[model samples]
Target: MLGLGAPELILIILAILLLFGYKKLPDASRSLGRSLRIFKGEMKGMKDDDVRSKDPARTTPVRGEIVAPADPAAELEAEARAAELRAAELRAQAERSRTADGPR
Candidate 1:
């Protein structure tokens, strides 16, 4: 497409074949096809969800009188806790890796 003619395309394909080898190309292609299919399916699902959200009747009705609107302070506090947990997990992972690598 990007100013690439048939010869350029052929050259690129040949290069890829050389890099990956013919024996593995089919498996790689299958994996790529499956990834594309999954991507398309997720995109379609998001679009359907968007459409459903736009229709009021599609959503569940509130069970009772709505409480006061959500507090931003509480949300921020929850987010901060989640971030701390993630950081702790990452630190643990790094420690494990360092131990496994054995004083390198």
Candidate 2:
């Protein structure tokens, strides 16, 4: 609908036909249609899930061990410490390797 007229549409169609030969066009269109159908189905399922989530009675209760509340700052600090440890370990390994390879 980008203000394209019949002639422009025809030209575009011709270009597509030229790009993808007629024999393959049908298969491509079929694949595209199937993808679109699957996408629509997924979108519908997501919307249904959202609706179910909004309705407490329709939602499933947690069955496993309850998870603790997230602590963003503490989690980040822990991750940073782990990364620092890994970096130190790598540096030590590299230093050992370099010393072993020295004068060789």
Candidate 3:
């Protein structure tokens, strides 16, 4: 591949062997093989996900009902409740500080 003939490939391998030595070559090759396999598997999974996403009938929810917007009144009520909780916490903190300061 990439214009590398058999002679060139052999030369490259010999150079790598000389550089890394015989002891580390097997470990390097095994790590390279594992990385390549993981890369290939991830690419395959991404392609499958792409195909599934493109097919609306396969990826879309079966119920097919559109969600309605949240009620503004309900949201406002929730905010008011949160504010009340914060106020209660602040009062409790003030009471604790007053007690700690001993009648100050």
Best by lDDT: 2
lDDT of 3: 0.90
How many clashing pairs in candidate 1? 0
Clashes of 3: 0
Q: Sort all candidates by lDDT, best to worst.
A: 2, 1, 3
Residues 53-94, model 2: lDDT tens digits: 999766675898465546888999999999999999999999
Give every collision pair in model 1.
Answer: none
| Greater-TM-score candidate between 1 and 2 | 2
* lDDT (tens digit, per residue) of candidate 3 on 39-70: 99999999999999999755755597765545
lDDT of 1 by residue, 2-103 (tens): 899999999999999999999999999999999999999999999999998899856545898455535889989999999999999999999999999998
**Cα lDDT, all candidates:** 0.91, 0.92, 0.90
Model 1: how far residue 39 lies from native, Å: 0.4
lDDT of 2: 0.92
TM-score, every prediction: 0.56, 0.58, 0.49
User: How many residue-pair clashes does candidate 2 contain?
Assistant: 0
